[model samples]
Target: MPVPTRKRSPFLTLLPWPERKALAEALRTETVGGLVLLAAAVIALVWANSPWSHSYETVRETHFGISALGLNLSVGHWTSDGLLTLFFLVAGVELKRELVVGELRTPAAAALPVVAAVCGMIVPAVLYVVVAGGGGGSLEGWAVPMATDIAFALAVLAVISTSLPSALRAFLLTLAVVDDLGAIFVIAVFFTSDLNILALLGALAGLVVFYILQRKRVRGWWWYVPLGVVTWGLMYNGGIHATVAGVAMGLILRATADDGTDGRKAEAMSPGDRTAHLLRPYSAAIAVPLFALFAAGVSVSLASLGDVFTRPEPLGVVLGLVVGKTLGIFCGTYLAARFTRARLNPDLSWADVFALSVLAGIGFTVALLIGELAFPDGAVAGHVKAAVLCGSLISAALAALLLKRRDRVYRRLCEVENRDDDADGIPDVYQQGQGEAK
Candidate 1:
C-alpha cells in the first residue's frame, strides 16, 4: 500500500505556529491603535471646525524643544516629525520580521504582495500626475496617495471579517508593510530639505555606533536611548526626515535571537523583538493617535469641501487613493499570478482579492503627512488634508461594504462545514431527520 500524501494550499500557505502567534499579536495591537487614531482624527476635525478653532490653532503652534540641538519645532511639527518616528519604528520592525522569518521569507510567498504593493504605489503616482500635472500643475504631491494605513485597514478588517481564513489577514498585513516601505523611501528621496553635510555625516556616525552596539550584544536601554535621540536630532538637522532615524535603528537591530558572543547565556528573545513588543503599545495607543490629532486638524467647510474636487492637486489625491489603488492592486496581483509561478490561494476567490485591494486604499496617516510635505503653504495644505480625509473615508466605506458581504458568505460556508451528520456528540439536523426516518 502507498502512504497518504498531503497537498498544500497555493500562494499563501499556513504560517508556522510561532509566526502566526506573532502576527496575531501585532494585528491586535494595530487594530486597537486604529480605533484610537480614528477617535483622535475625529476630535481634531471637530475642534478645528468648532467655535474654539482659534484655541486649536494656538495649541498647534506652540513650540518647545532642545534649542541647542536645533530641535525646537511647533507642536504640529513635533507630532509629525517626532512622535511619528515611533510609528515608523514599529513599521520597520514589522518589515524586519516579515523579511527575515514571516510570510516574506520566501520569494514566491513574497512576490504576491510585493508585486501588488509596487503596482499599488506606481498607479497612484501616475494617476496623481495625470490629474494634477496639467498646465504645469506641480507634480510635488505625486507620492501622497501611495500608502495604506495598516492600523486602520486592519481595524476595518477585524470589524467586517469573521470566519475568513487567516491567510487573508497575513496577506493584507504583508502588503501594507511593503506599501509603508515604499512610502518611507519616497519620503527619504523626494521630500528632503537643503542638505547639511556635517549634520548628515554625524547622524551616519551615530548610526554606525548604534549598529556596533547591537553587534557587540550591548544590552542597556540607558546606553542606546540617548544615542537614539542624538541620532534623530542629527538626522532632522541633516535635511532628512527624522523618522528615517527610527527605521534605521530598527533595521540595524537583530531580528533573531542569538548565542551569547561574550561569556553570557543566550537570551530567549532578540533585541528587535523585545523592543517592538515593549514599544508597540505606546506606538499604537499614544504615538500615532497623538500625531493624527495634530495632523488631521484641517478645518472643514463647504468651500474647503468643494476645493477637494475642483482643485487639481486635491482632486488628484482623492482619485489616486480610491480609483488608482483599487485597480492597480487588483490588476497587479492578477498579472503576477498569471505570468509567474505564484498561484491564488484555493480558499480565496477573485472577488475576495478585489475587496482586499479596495481595502488598501485607506491611506490615512502617511497620506496626510505627505500632503503637508508636498503643500507647505497653509491654504493648499489644508485642502490636501481635506482630500485625504475624504478619500480615506470613501475607501473605508466601500471596503466595509465589500468585506461584510464576503464575511457572510464565508460564515455560511463555515456553518455547512461544521455541520456533521456522523459526529458522536450532539447530532446535526440531517442525522436527527434520518434517525426519525429509520
Candidate 2:
C-alpha cells in the first residue's frame, strides 16, 4: 500500500505578496522572543560561573535609588518588585478577560480547568506540607508549586513546536492562566506579613481612586501609571507583597477602558475582546520576555548544586516542583475529566495529558519568587534557588520527550482517520452524482 500524504492548501500557497510578507514578519517577532529568552539563560549560566561572578552578583544586588522620589532598591529588587509589576498587571488583565469572555467565560467551559487548577494547587501544597512536615516553619513555602510560569511553559512548547497540536497548546495556556490566578490568591492571602494599617488604608484608597477613574472611562495608561506606583509603594509598606498592587491596578484599569467599537457607544464590548486587544501584544511581545530575562538570571555553580541538596527546604521545594507538580496536575486533571462532564482536549490522549503535566513541573519564575518570599536569608534560600533551577530543567526535558512520543501517536491516528474517510469515497460519490444530473 502507498503511504497517504496530507494535502496542502492551495489558498495558503496563493496568498498575496503583502499578506505573506506580513505573516512572515509576525512569525519572526514570535521567534525572536523565544530566542531572546534562550540566549539570556545561556549568558546567565556562563556569567554566574565565570571569574566575573562577583561582578554579576554586584550588578544584580547593587542598590539604586530615586532619592527625590524616595525609591531605593537593588537592581534585582527593581526588576522583581518594580518592573515585574507590569508583567503581573498584564497577567491580571488576561485573567479578568478570561473570566469575563474567554475560555473561562462560562461554567461549562471553565469548570474543567478550574477544577483541574484547584486540584493542581491543593495536591502540590499538600505534598509539600507532608514532605516538609508540619513544624519548623518549613510549611511557609506551600504555595511555591502552585504557580505555572506561562512564558517558560510556552517556551518549552516552542522547543517541540512541530510535535504538539494547537489544541494541546491552547489547553496548557488556559490551564496555566488558571494556575496563575490560584497562585496570586495564595500569595495575597497566605504569604502576607504583619499589616501596617496606615499603609494598608493608603493602598486601598489608591485602588478605589483607580477604580473610580476606570468607571469614568479613562482611555490612556498615563493616568494610572503614577497611581499604580504609589499603590505598589503603599502595599509594600502595608506588609502585603507589592506585586498584588499591580494585579489590582490592572484589573481596575482594564475594567474601565473603552474598547474601540462601532464608533458609537463604548459599553458594547464583550469584555474579553476589549481587554485582550488592549493587553495581548504588549504582554506577549514585551513585558513577559523582559521579566524572563531579569528573573531567570540566577547564579550557577558546581559547588552550589552539592550544597543545595543538603538543605531540607531546598530539597522539599525541588521535589515538590518536579515530582509534586507532575503527579498533582496529571492526577487532578485526569480524575476530574474522567469523573466529570468537563471534556478533555479532543486531540489529546492520556499520554499527552501526562506529558503536559510533566512540563507543568517547570516552575522556574514563580518558584524563584516564592523562594525569595519564603526564605529571606540563610542557607535555605540558596538551596531553594538551586533546586528550582535543577528541577525545572529536568522536568522540561522529560516533558518534551513525552510530548514528542505522544505527538507521533496522535498524528498517526489522525492520518488513519483521514485515510478511512477518503476510502469511504464520500466526496467522490457526491461529485459523480452531481455530474450525472448535470
- lDDT per residue (tens digit) for residues 1-438 in model 1: 999889856878789899966755663465667788999999999999999999999999999989768777999999889989988987888889898999889998889889999999999999999999873467889999999999899999987777777778888999999999999999999999999999999999999999999988899899899999999999999999999998888888889887778566688998888888888777877788888999899889898899899998889999999999999999999999999999877777888889999999999999988988998886878988999999999999999999999898999876775765335555475667889999
TM-score of each: 0.89, 0.81
| lDDT winner | 1
Cα shift from native, residue 77, model 1 (Å): 0.7
Cα distance off (Å), candidate 1, residue 12: 47
Give, for candidate 1, the lowest lDDT window spanning 10 residues.
420-429
Global local distance difference test of model 1: 0.89
lDDT string, candidate 2, 1-438, tens digits? 999999977874668889856644553343454455556656766776788878877887789887644678887777667766766776777677777657888887777667766776777777778767743447777777667777677877876767467877767877888887777787788778999899999999999998887665565568776877788898887878888887787666553335556463456663334654555455555555555554555555667777556555666677777788778878887788888888886767778778888888878776778777787667666667677778788888898788778777767867776676698866654767889999
